[model samples]
Target: LIADEYIKMSDGTYPVLFVANKGRNVLLGREAVMRKEKMQTNQIVKDDELFERLRALRRKLAQEQGVPPFVVFSDETLREMSGKVPLT
Candidate 1:
């Protein structure tokens, strides 16, 4: 899939892909340029304050439920949540 559409100075020099399930088209190369720009600037991607708050919440919930923090929510899930910051 990459080799077919790969292009330098246009679609980005590196590949950053995420294939969705249910045969959905994810616009494979669309974000490549944006990601490349971010990578070049050494961007701080994660929202540290929100992430820490989520971790603290996870810890509290875990303690209350008598299970590990990961059992409540994985770190990756928290990171995604912090990145998106969904209101609902």
Candidate 2:
């Protein structure tokens, strides 16, 4: 896991556990990961069938709960779920 904190000395940084634990890659901040996830979602949401199905599902769920579709689930979340289809 990436540990985020302020450093007392110079440079001002904490540490990530990965390098110490033999993990090769270091994914930096939450914002960076979110940006990357959004990029991946772009590809999934482009699928016509999946998009339509999720749109319908989102509408139905929102109506049942008396809330907006976006409140039920954002397009990105629906796209991510669509990408991982037949979820278990």
> TM-score of each candidate?
0.47, 0.48
Model 2, span 1-88: residue lDDT tens: 3343221223337633324221222233323222234343236354669878989999999999999999999987887787777746
Weakest lDDT window of 10 consecutive positions for candidate 1: 18-27
As a whole number from 0 to 100, the lDDT of residue 58 in candidate 1 is 100
lDDT of 1: 0.69
Taken over the whole model, the C-alpha lDDT of each candidate is 0.69, 0.62
TM-score of 1: 0.47
Local accuracy of candidate 1 as per-residue lDDT tens digits, 1-88: 4443332223467755644331133355434332334345433536899999999999999999999999999987888788887668
Scored against the true structure, residue 62 in model 1 reaches a CA lDDT of 100
Clashes of 1: 0
User: What are the runs in model 2 whose C-alpha is more than 4 Å off?
Assistant: 1-46, 86-88
Q: What is the lDDT of residue 52 in candidate 1?
A: 95
Candidate 1 — which residues are off by over 4 angstroms?
Answer: 1-44
